[model samples]
Target: MDVQLRQLRAFVAVVDEGTFTDAAILLGVSQAAVSRSVAALETTLGTRLLDRSNQRVTLTGAGGRIVTRARRVLDEVDRLERIAQEARPELRVGYAYAALGKHTRHLMKAWAVAHPAVPLMFVQSNTPTAGLSEGIADIAVIRRTLADERFDMASVGCEARYAAVDTEHPLARRRSVRLEQLTRYTVAIDKRSGTTTPELWPATMRPQTRTVDGVDEWLTVIAGGQAIGVTAEATANQNPRPGVAYRLVTDAPRIDVRLAWWRDDPPPCLDTLLAMIRELYSAAPPGLPRQRVPMVVPPRARGRH
Candidate 1:
């Protein structure tokens, strides 16, 4: 008999328990079966695995080596099983840089409970809303998006855009200010996540520009009155930066939060997750514009030759 897994199990159990009878009880096998397995293993390995005399059962040098190797083999087998179990019912979800806030974290936990069967896999990407179109993700939560003929778009929520400014700013006294009123102030944004190029170049105001990796840094600058910024409402509430205040941007585009999936036949649970998400977070719809990547028409089609 070649060195086998069963033999190793029996050998380890007997060594661990210090007796064949105890090992048999632990393994739920007869004592004679346990003893036979160990003896077989010793013969196959050509090494005495244990020192046994009278009532004493101890490991030999060879036995010590086998046990060390055996434990590793068992551990690897267990790991493979766990990985296999996690691979089922998986969802590849993506979020944009700005959208990766407390809402995502909170919604993730709620989503987990709502759909215990789905294995969610999320990635933060620049193309947050286009994930479904690019075939990189099953779903995406995005802001500044619009209806896509290729997609069945509906508002999951929205985030009110806050005019971030210092406590001492001239406009800070009022509860709110129209976006156009801040034309004179510098505006920083996550330009990467924006839909337009130079993105601020298309704007009415040529405000000073500052590109940030995320919202936290923008908050700091806003608090210092160096530059004003816009943030999702959920973010503003998380930590209203010290010496800083936020208020609605009047006539400003509210960030539209949407749950977008492929217009094609989606997984059954996708529908369920969407329903639960709406039910749970239906209150306080994130205030923001619903934006989308529009399919561009060819120049040939646009000109009336």
Candidate 2:
């Protein structure tokens, strides 16, 4: 049947208000218009929806069933409209691991104050490029270099490295551990999305590698003493596992924090986001050991394979 959203709204309003006159007042239209809308809805559904022989209008048996369904339809239409309105001019940023690490709250609050007109959303995905490659995000916070030449990236900050081990593991007793010390244990790595790789270690001293899919799995395996995990300081800050202890990886290379977007159609606020993130990292507490660095990818090197 050709039922319109307006007709459903009118039907719901009439039922809620208990009279066509009241519904017309709520809808800001004449009583005749409200009556006509309800009539059209009943005609389209091919059913008697209301009995209006007396001053008090009442629903027929079919009207009760149809009103319930019509109200749901109208409510859903209202929700759809609201979603469209709210999503317009909104920004969705994706991340696979620690989202800005310790600076997440500061970044969000600052963004809200700086761009009150735009809504910022953080979407989490476990894929290598967060959700960027899947078209689920406008930009992504990535820890590793994106292999795709279609993307342009900027390094906003760098985080120190940490080694995650079980609380009961011998290495956990130490305040910090060297990369070579971790080589003695099996290393749990999320090869697809993680920044750590066997190449981080000297070829002869490479630890036996165990594959993991995501941060949760890596933590679980590490906590169970199945393997040790090497990750950026952000992961340790964001995920403090009860059974897992994170020790500084004193000898490992720092992890670069990069913001990436599709080069051909970069978001308008890309530059602003990068600048704000750089500021947040730069202003971070010195104890966190955050390093503020200029964009590592040169203008000439951007968008290049």
Candidate 3:
């Protein structure tokens, strides 16, 4: 009954940043404010939240559950407020090449017909650079990859991986391929620094690695018979060069088209964007995956429970 937005905000900050001091810095508030907010939140919920000792803070069992729900609620509230302030305008969405797959044409056509009045702004983004980290997209249809925690994400769908080689290449005849098998060939990937590569590639197949600037450039190398490459079905669809083809890599994670917001509290322009994105992703054909951590196991306990 006495719950407050500040309490929720404070708790989420600590859970994400891992320290009262860090949360306070991010909120531009005193550490005391953070500690007080968390304490008050625990009292209101009738649960002990943190176990702090040894100068290291840890979340209790209940803290994990509470923080998860609090993040969702706070995020929605933020988005709602922004939506209220800004009159509906055309939604702008940012995405890398792989996010908009072969079916993008179909999706756009249907979206236009359904919400023609709402202008749709789509920008093609190449490479996963500071643009996404700095909050450049409302919904970023990125490659089959897990976005960093810094971004609010909604999975579009999985992008199946394909192996592209010259027509006369030995492995071209096979319906599928693996990373281990491609070790001998030259490999190309959109190297996303700071993100986990193993999560993207489940199978252990290492090829001579190379990074390309854009999809077209990547296609050129593939078409020239200079290198073998792995790409999502969407990338293959978007850049259909004559000499290249992609098939199941066996190890590719299901790529997802995610709706992202810089902060949990999104801007109003973001709401329309999110709404439109949600509508699009909801009806998306199978193969896209959203984030689902099986169980958020908190760090080891330190202070009293």
- Who wins the lDDT comparison? 2
RMSD of 3: 22.7
TM-score of 2: 0.68
Candidate numbers, best lDDT first, in rank order = 2, 1, 3
- Assess candidate 1 and give its lDDT: 0.68
Error of 1 at 166 (Å): 1.1
Best by TM-score: 2
The residue ranges of model 3 lying beyond 4 angstroms of the native Cα positions read 1-88, 129-137, 144-150, 193-205, 264-305
Candidate 3 lDDT, 1-305, residue by residue in tens: 79899999998898788899999999999999999999999999999988887476888999887778898999999999998878565555666655466566666776688778765656666646324554554455554445467666655445466676765566766667776787777776666521223334435554456776666777788778787777666666666667665556786555545556565656445554556555655676633222121232346854538
Report the lDDT of model 2 for residue 107. 87
TM-score of each: 0.56, 0.68, 0.53
- Give lDDT for model 2: 0.86
Candidate 2 off by > 4 Å? 1-86, 285-305
Q: Tens digit of lDDT per residue, candidate 1, span 115-219?
A: 777767676566536466676777876665545776766676555667667877776666677756777777777764543223423365656667765556667
Of 2 and 3, the candidate ranking higher by lDDT: 2
Task: Write out the backbone clash pairs for model 2.
Answer: none
lDDT of each: 0.68, 0.86, 0.66
